[model samples]
Target chain A: MTANWAAVLGSCAIAYAIKLSGHLVPHRVLQRPLVRASAALFPVALLSALMAMQTLTTKGAIEVDARIPAMAAAALALRARWPFIAVVAVAAVVAAGVRALGWMS
Target chain B: MTTKPRSVIIRDAISIGIAVGAYAISFGALGTTSGLTVLQTQLLSLLLFSGASQFAVVSIVGAGGNPASAWASSALLGMRNGLYGLRLAPLLGASGWRKPFAAHLTIDESTAMALANDDPADSSHRGARTGFWATGLSVFVFWNTATLLGAVAGSHISDPRVFGLDAAIPAGFAALVAPRLTTSLTRGLALVCAVVAVAVTPSVRPGVPVLIAALIALTTAMKFGEPIPPTTEDVSS
Candidate 1:
């Protein structure tokens, strides 16, 4: 298998092991404050980072583009309590419109 | 506590399934655009089976990060699923072969539905079990089916940028994080992490900045010494 495939399978193994550990490990151990805190906040932080990475840069360099407006539109849709799919759609439409207008790409 | 009828549970599960599963289309499209084959994408859904984690992998790879970075980020995101499994373990009380199955199905929606139906006085946990299984199976079927459909269709699209599908990546992450930022502290942390990620991007490799931001956020959270109550179902899964 290629490196990508290996990464995919390795990720799968790690994910499953983590999941099964929750079932197999004692509940008390998992309930510790640090463990719980890590689980709760890690995603919040990682996702925020991921969003910034995707929106603010292209190919590992800082670049401004249509993704900015797309994210703004998505934020509005989320604030309005629009459905998840609609939020994504609004972002896509806004980005497409912006790029089409030659404002950004 | 009163349990809803079994039919209601089934309906709710399927509706939630449909809602959540529809996002798999984005995953499918993004996966292909990131250079993953349709089969590889499908395997991600079937094996990894967690929405945010799968998205992390694709986004990291699409950004030209190395394979190791892609694996670490995705696995880090998948850590939450393990927490969900922790929450469901006592409640679901599965055994033998069923243990693995139940563990795999433990996700935000399943845990939320199960706990919502649980009664402190009811030792049998019948309603909780039903909620867990129904929601889990519903999402599994819908998610896999949607992934297949999206992958097939996305393969034909030559330019994701033209369709704004490229922009959809960040938008999707924003949606995932929005619901979780229920508290002011979490929101602040998110903002800080976003700034940190952008600030460090040029100095570091593609995925390393994200990991750095995450480490900083974790340390900050630890310093605060209170786990943010994950009250809402952060329903990307």
Candidate 2:
């Protein structure tokens, strides 16, 4: 438990460092095109990677299942411009229902 | 600087609260499912509201990784928030005291809400302030509350996998990523990074694959020299 707390604090500290680094440096220095460009792409890069991991992996293996149904529901939600909550709820319900009904066990 | 209406701030806060609170239910359920004690689950939600990071930590802990490794993986996944703080500084950089709070609120959802406003030129500051406070407080309250609820009642809610709670992460990511698909370069970069990450996930730690994908996307963006599109909406009143 002590180790876990230490790990959590350490992680928070590291996150704080990264955040402070940008502010500590002169604004002019960071305004360079290269720097701005790099910063702009960071979220896209990070999110893409995250999405891949979440969508493609299943218990340490690469396999597809009920995710296909969820993705279809997500597509509909996106097209309809539904709120985030609505989209998530719809996907969960659909996926769950499919699994519960033994359609995709 | 003209002060924004209190009503607007309140509305933003409420909306954020609802959205964040709903998501926290899943977080809490996941925490319990992963075998975390109630206190630990609540603490994770309270301290680390970043969904991806929390998920990584819980997965590692569940898989029997040491605390240090879990923390490292979670921290690596959360590095994107640092980038968000940098982008948000100009808009929300108030005095010294508020800086930390503002930074805390600059997560993915708040940033998107602020950037999605209709009047970016005149209302950017107000939007930023609204987004920051709304998201920060909402996340803080909703996450802790949902975690507590889940911890207490998690057992009754059997078969979280059956409910497809796991899909929340992907759906959330899609919402974030779909908006960025304005340009071919960005779309291409996103595609390549996702494909690469998925392909390599079997071999490496889960977080490491994403980190490598980030690197690949960044390098690709650098080489191609693409411009970021302007804000999708302007919330200037």
Candidate 3:
């Protein structure tokens, strides 16, 4: 219980540090091409890492499950430019549907 | 008299705010189902005020990752907000208390709204300023309200698995990241990261693989030499 609180507060602090520290950065420093470019791509990297981690883990191994189809459905929704809420709802349905079909445990 | 363009900005901000806020329900439900208490989920949204990082942390802890790893990975996800703030600071011109308040609200939607409304013709940056504050404050209020509503709803469920929400949470996460995979390079890197993480997960602890997968982003960005403009938030653009 205590660990949960600690992690929550610590993560919030780090997030604020990133925000406030960015404010402290001189404008000229941010204008640098490398800094600007890396900042733009960091989300792609971090989010992609998240995507893989979420998709690949099941039962403590790299296994395909209902999540695969569900995510595929979501990727398609994103491509079609569906809004965020719709994408999530569609993914949930697809995953739940796949499970209902007994496609995977 | 609101000009056409000004009304458009307001309209867009409110629509986007509702869109972003509605998604908080998913986060609340999933965070609760993933082992976080309702208050923990609510606190994550209120304090962190970042959808992706909050969801990621809850997901990480729910998956049994240690607190340190969860916080580290969540930090990496939140780092973009710093860059976002750097881009926004001058436009906001916030100092003292307003500075921290502005910093807290400098999220993807706020940044995107401000950038979208950049008016080269307007010397005062009125459009951008309005966009930032409007979108930021609206999203914040709606998101927090929606989070509480969702958490209350989530708390009523006797067993989260009965609705298959446990799987839905990760699937929802995948959906969130899907739009970012615009290029073949990104898709390939994601695949590689997935493979590596899976290979490592069996032998290591739960949270370690996502941290390891984070390396794939760095290497790919280094090799590619340009980071794509963020597409996750601004779907219309």
Per-candidate DockQ values are 0.77, 0.46, 0.53
lDDT of 3 by residue, A15-40 (tens): 88877877778777655555554555
> At residue A8, what lDDT does model 2 achieve?
53
- Going through the candidates in order, the fraction of native interface contacts each one reproduces equals 0.75, 0.45, 0.48
TM-score pick, better of 2 and 3 = 3
lDDT tens digits, residue span B1-237, model 2: 344565776577666667667766766766666666667777776666666567666655543446766666565556556655666677665668887666555556666555443245664577556656665677677767876886666545566677786665567667656766777877887888888877887887645665676577558657865467323231111
lDDT of 3: 0.74
Worst 10 residues of 1 chain A by lDDT: A1-10
What are the per-residue Cα lDDT tens digits for candidate 1 across B80-156? 77777877888888999999999888777888889877777889888899899999999999999999888888899
Q: Name the regions of candidate 1 deviating beyond 4 angstroms.
A: B231-237
Task: Tell me how far the alpha carbon of residue A17 in candidate 1 is from the true structure, in angstroms, after superposition.
Answer: 0.8
Tens digit of lDDT per residue, candidate 3, span B1-237?
A: 222276787888888778788989888887777777889888888889987788888877777777898788888788778778887877777788888888888788888888777776666778888888888898998898888888888878877654666656766666666666777877777677666776777898877777776666666666666656544355325
Inter-residue clash pairs, candidate 3: none
Which model scores highest in DockQ?
1
TM-score of chain A of each: 0.94, 0.76, 0.85
What is the CAPRI rating of model 1's predicted complex? medium
Superposed by TM-score, candidate 3 places the C-alpha of residue A7 at a distance from the truth, in angstroms, of: 2.2
TM-score of predicted model 3? 0.90
Q: State how far residue A80 of model 1 sits from its true place (Å).
A: 0.8
Error of 1 at A59 (Å): 0.8
Which model is ahead, 1 or 3, in terms of TM-score?
Answer: 1
